[model samples]
Target: MTAAGLPMEIRAEGLPTRVRIHEVGARDGLQNEQTVVPTEVKAEFIHRLADAGLPTVEATSFVHPKWVPQLADAERLFPLLGDLDPHRLPVLVPNERGLDRALALGARRIAVFASATESFAKANLNRTVDEALAMFAPVVARAKDAKVHVRGYLSMCFGDPWEGPVPLAQTVRVCRELLELGCDELSLGDTIGVATPGHVQHLLASLNEAGVPSSRLGVHFHDTYGQALANTLAALQHGVTTVDASAGGLGGCPYAKSATGNLATEDLVWMLHGLGIETGVDLDRLVATSVWMAEALGRPSPSRTLRALSHKE
Candidate 1:
């Protein structure tokens, strides 16, 4: 949306003074690295992110060690990050067992995922979409009973690797069931990051038509084709406020061969701040932290902002 005379970049949605950044670096970023980040380093990285005033950071995933060995220390990582305030540490629980382990380790917030495409479900979770959701239903129910907040992920929202473009109605129905089944919020994931502005606009429009309001939705995009930012603009124009981003553009799905890293935190914040949109995040500190994590893992950051900002005199 072009403002009256703002260079046709993006118009202000006049959103609230701030938006929450759900940092997925620790888990999402490191999980794909072949190098195992020592437990202390992982803990320290998480601590630094919290210290940077990033209100919510996804500490790590509690999936089985065999599935993602890097996050195998999910239990150890939690206590090591023990000093972090409790209200913001959201961990991903792959199933009931994952939730149980996370709860025992004192996680107050947890997340689970569902596939919008059947082939994605089969390949990722080894179950049909219904089977996967059925598996998650009890987990959500129990989490609600325990006063633990649950966030849901709906992967392949606009399109999928296996099934090609997904029906917008199917996306709406799954999202509605997730919210009705007790998810506090739903993140629409573009697994392969192939979503275009038209795809985003069409999906949101269809969702609104189906009585699915924008308030319940968050956007999770990959930068595979470098369309994440533009697609985000579409979501914002349509009134979807919350966004999920990973620091340094860290993390990609091992299963999706085409899945690139997530939208970079530094870059996203830069664009938002340029538009006078409040992300309540310090761009410098975030860039520093991304560099730290990248350094710890001995890899270069994927964030263009960090690269440019770090070289500032």
Candidate 2:
């Protein structure tokens, strides 16, 4: 039975026996929140997520404060995470400057954000696709020299809000470049939540053709059209094991109007457990953490798993 108490489907033949759920609740989820969650609260949230058995938690972004004021306390918050395994805490660094800050703060794992479409690249990073990659090239190189693990996030892999249905080849080219630039892993993001299962397959196929291995890739999906889990299943069947999820469905693209919150960690855990795949996450503890965070945000969590589990008598 699933966490929703629904009957489970037959086991997927090609899916990996275990999947790594990269918890992005602290960074991606909270960046778009209107409320400026205190540095202490953000630290507590990440600690709780780690306590729930999420080994890979995206801690915070070192981006400029003017753009994402919600996460302005990255400098302060990074130190508070001293107890966490540094290898497990990946922070987002937009450019060399951000990378410098992260390195200075002793961040051993960092992520750089790029885009598949010209419009999204321009909108999010204030640069064209190549220009953004150029900016990330040195950042990735420096992080590599520092012996830090670097993750590259390629957003708008399926469709862009401004330019619909991005070409699979275009996304693949960016993936290859980021890999060449020394990213240990590439996270393909459906930034606007427009990816379906077919789109996910096509994108993965194209990346494979570009010499990008499924082992070096992860999928990040938004649930706006309710296809996040289905798209994730497609990736899983394709042999992609790492997935990016936010706790309590607490995220949205601040720049893209069409983008919604990411696939909820609780919901994803529920489905993965039902599928007999190991994620090492405690569902009840994860839900309780999200519910506690929801109260901090002064709103209920959007996760169906959290909602259903919370209502149990």
Candidate 3:
């Protein structure tokens, strides 16, 4: 039994025994912060995340400095990650210009972001759904030609802050477009954290029917409504193995009001370990890392598990 008196046996049925956590603390997590983190600090954060045994760590974004000034040091940041395996570091690229910056910095993996709703598309990317897809098509094609892996992020998949609920067909169509454009994986994002297990299962079922295998998809959830963990379980039950999490629950959506940050890595690790699923992350070490980051950010981590464990320590 764990210190919390919880049994160590796997709880969820039909869930994958091993889950690959795509760590997003350095990129998606920090981008929403008001503070412009120093490039050296960002580098250190990524290094510590990788040192904590996270297999995949999203390094930074290649967007214009005027847009996301928090990560404007992307050019300076990528080179500091020479110690990390190139395959394990992915940076977010906004368009061909962003892609070019990432390529110039020798990025081997990149992620592109799109939205499932028109309001989000206009608010976040300044384009319609089709326009954003059209913009990403050539980006993905070029990345593939350069032998770089590409991942697609579809935000507001569950519910949009401005548009309310998103339709399943629109979500599936965006997923199909990214896949057809040669993206290696697609991460469905609950930008506003309004998803329930039923919504998650229904969406996965729709994507499955649309011929998108669970293997090619990842789930990115926010804990705004405290439903991130539940939604993650639902996705795992539907056979999604790649899960995106931030180290300390460090970010929120600037475009979507009241949207909390990505799901915490510590919280996800606790649940996955309780389920007897392997994530190859040491729970104590991960918690300590998050607490350390909390100190850096001058606030407590938003993860319940981290808060509890850090207090105990």
Model 2: how far residue 124 lies from native, Å: 0.8
Model 2 lDDT per residue over 1-313, tens place: 2445542655668889999999999999999988799999999999999999998999999999999999899999999999999999999999889998999989999999999999999899999999999899899999999999999999999999888998888888889999999999999999989889998998898888879999999999999999999999999999999999999999989989988899999999988988889899988789889999999999999899889888876
The collision pairs in model 2 are none
Error of 3 at 148 (Å): 0.6
Model 1, span 1-313: residue lDDT tens: 1132122235375444456678888888788888788999988888888877788999989999998999898888899877787668999998999999988988999999899988999988999888989999999999999999899999989888888989988888888888888999889999999899999989999888887788878899999999988998788878887888898999888778889999998887877776667777877678788888887777789888788877665
Candidates 1 and 2 compared by TM-score, better number:
2
Clashes of 3: 1
TM-score, each model?
A: 0.94, 0.97, 0.96
Q: Please provide, for model 3 over 251-273, each residue's C-alpha lDDT reduced to its tens digit, 9 standing for 90 to 100.
A: 87878887878899988998998
- Sequence-dependent TM-score of model 3: 0.96
lDDT ranking of the models: 2, 3, 1
lDDT of each: 0.85, 0.92, 0.89
- Candidate 3 Cα outliers beyond 4 Å, as residue runs: 1-7
